[model samples]
Target chain A: MSSQSVVFKPEISKPLLQEVMDRSGQNVLACYQCRRCAAGCPVGDETGVTPDRLIRMILLGEKNEAFNNLLVWKCVACYTCGTRCPNNIQTARINEILKQMSKEAHIEPLNPKVAAFHNAFLTSASHFGRVNELEFMSLYEIQNTRSELKRGGGWRAIVDKIKDRAKLGISMMKKKRLHFKLDKIKGLSEIKRLYAKAREKSVDR
Target chain B: MEIAYYPGCSLHASSELYDIQSRMVFRRMGVELKEIEDWNCCGATSAGKTDDFLAIALPARNLGIADASGLAEIVIPCSSCYSRMIVSQKKLADDPGLKNTINAELIKKAEGKIKISSILEVLVSKANSGEIAEKSIKNLEGIKPACYYGCLLTRFPCDVEIPDSVENPQGMEIVCKIIGAQPIDWSYKTDCCGASAVINDTDTSLLLMSRILHDAVARGANCFVTTCPMCQLNMDAYQEQVGEKYGIQKRLPVYFITELLGIAMGFSPNEMQLDRHFIDPFGLLTELKLI
Candidate 1:
């Protein structure tokens, strides 16, 4: 997932902080490390740090820590913490922000599998404009397996993946029932233009 | 209007209960759905991950058939399918070159025409609150349900924000309240359950689901409701797995919003496909005196 490295040294400006707070709410600055956001976050226990802590780190301009921490990667983007934050913080959105920052900074991915999946997700959207889960999962597994092999332990797992291919194929084949024609949508051209614009923006950023 | 319905792969397999309950719920709600004569796959997450053209083509092919068969909209019960179809539809509607490529592929697969829509949007629009109000047999009281949107339902339509608040939506809550249930304030309404990955990746799914269950229990919620079959399957079937792994034994029955509505309307467990659920929704109904 890392095409480049992003280095941050807590040089956050006031306007950026205000913009996040405005989109989310002003109470985000009121978080006092109570960890309520983490306590209630659905993915918090699975993550290294709580959602509240992640947000605090960001608010305090701990840009490097916020972007590089594994906590930022573990978020499922479920929006649980965002809905429950007493500080009215959009923890999920903040997580999205961190993810984007990580992408920009090219931080080492905590879970290369997820990063592969994320890349696959974007690539699929950019190309076809919709995700085909079966293809996506297969590609995700392949990419993840390749990443694992690069780290020197994925070869054994490859056999298991191959052994399970039949079952996987069965599951993948199940996707055939809900197909639809794409030519009839009233807004096809605009959507493609927007997608191209987005891809360019992300690449530029 | 009779429209072709694609229940997706999951509805026929992993979470057939959603398919069953949705059929019953839709029937009661007075909406007619006819299955497509010969439908193909939508090429779900895997397709989307690997090949963009395949992903769009998968869902697009299905819509083409529905359209050719003379149905403007194909109502889908599975959240993944709904999201895929909507995203694909929007993409096709927005991109001419992609639409041409997708349409050409679809014509070879099917001889029909169709549009795509999620059951959630169908409930909100096609079979509206007016119809629901007219056919009301029971109203939920003292049962504060938190309408869980999961992720697929609201992520698209990036403009106009069709459902409710992007973060915490109340559309399902409003639907429940309209049918007479008091929607509660819960923290994990939009949280993911580590869904389809739970099969391949256990630890993460367990950890995530445990946190969600813990949050709901802490909020004093008696039950959980959702639109996605994967979310329902993971949340319900994996509850045991999660508890076993974490040593935290907490069980909150998860129901398809349709099943809850079925019961509220005095429908039996059989009618709502309660017997098919990993957790017996009937047990919760009995506890709530809803059955």
Candidate 2:
């Protein structure tokens, strides 16, 4: 892949590089350019870089390429590559650390379709403190710019929504008879307390 | 012995069977579940994916709340919640700055200190499997179940040491065996079934679930058992979806490990909420003559 394909600049500072090396056991540089990690990865073909390429970029301090590649994000952390690695290198953990770094880097827009699930997940958690599958799906549909039914006169989307609504309605009805007792959660107050503490620390920093 | 329990959001709502069966089984085993009151979501995958603090705060808040409740170890049943709680606890525990920041919130919230542990750990380390086996009134006998860990159970193996090897977890299998069910060995035990992603994106979720189910069925597993509510929900709720989407006509039943244990312990279907499953588990239990 061309270096120009990356939309953002690299943040390969010495400290970041040191951190990666520290977590990866200095084995990131030990990769002899073997394609085994790439070959062993089931989803390698779908991402831009193979597991080997991802590690190489990190080893070379190409933080931008290492962080932005779909290879790091798409890895289900199945540990297949890590388990199969001849060097006993933990590729899955390394991939996750890189993904974390990528998030912190504030990369630009991903595919609009891909963003649907992420948005739904965040909206659900931000509001309910838990995932609401029905709400998440509905919100995703709306964000996709697709109505309850797909455009072009197809009724599939409408049917899906109708079915979804019925199920959701039934679920809510059943839930009403049960006592949720949300008040019993002891950590809510403490978490709020912790949040305030965190804010104060940030301000102090 | 009394212990702290974190019944994740699903257990209180969609996957109520897990909560019901867990409570019953724990009671039967003479274990006390001191529920952590007013606990929030664990942020699962969403909070972390969107914003680090959002995800961190979700689990961190719950952990702090559990801590304030004065529990030494929080026993979580849901794999997603379990992983997030333990990981977030470790993160906060290791980072003094983060802990100090959260502790300020703890001071305001009036909750005490807490540590996180999965129910697997609690049952294995504290409950004593020998006692559980001795308490078993009935055996699972001929039922062959696929022991599924999904993705979240042991993602960060360092934080927790579940009974089996993280790479090849056998805790549930041991529990299943003690109850008389045969644990089918398969490569997909730790594989990802795409978790909550299935509800939002059918394509990805189906593909992943199909792979898992296909592997289990191919290996002659009569039913699939798991420790996570989300995994159970996905596997059970989307059976028809996966079949229709993939053109497979067979029915694959999924059960929470607790439900099977509850059944083996001579609990009735009503006690385990077996009637509420999307894919009926009674047929399998009846076929095994455990009903």
* Candidate 2 per-residue C-alpha lDDT over B92-123 given as tens digits, one digit per residue, 9 for 90 to 100: 65667755655554433323356566767665
Please name the candidate that would achieve the greatest DockQ relative to the true structure. 2
Best by TM-score: 2
lDDT of 1 by residue, B1-291 (tens): 566788765665556567777787777766677876445456555444323445566666667656666767788877677766776777677677767755654443332345566777777663354876666677677666556777667653222235557677767876777777777788767667777446445577787787777777778777788888878877876677687787766577787888767776678876655665555556666766777
Each candidate's DockQ score against the native complex?
0.09, 0.29
lDDT of each: 0.63, 0.67
Model 1 has a DockQ score of 0.09
- Candidate 1's TM-score: 0.63
For candidate 2, chain B by itself scores a TM value of: 0.92
Q: Which ten residues in a row have the lowest lDDT in candidate 2 chain B?
A: B103-112
User: What does the lDDT come to for candidate 2?
Assistant: 0.67
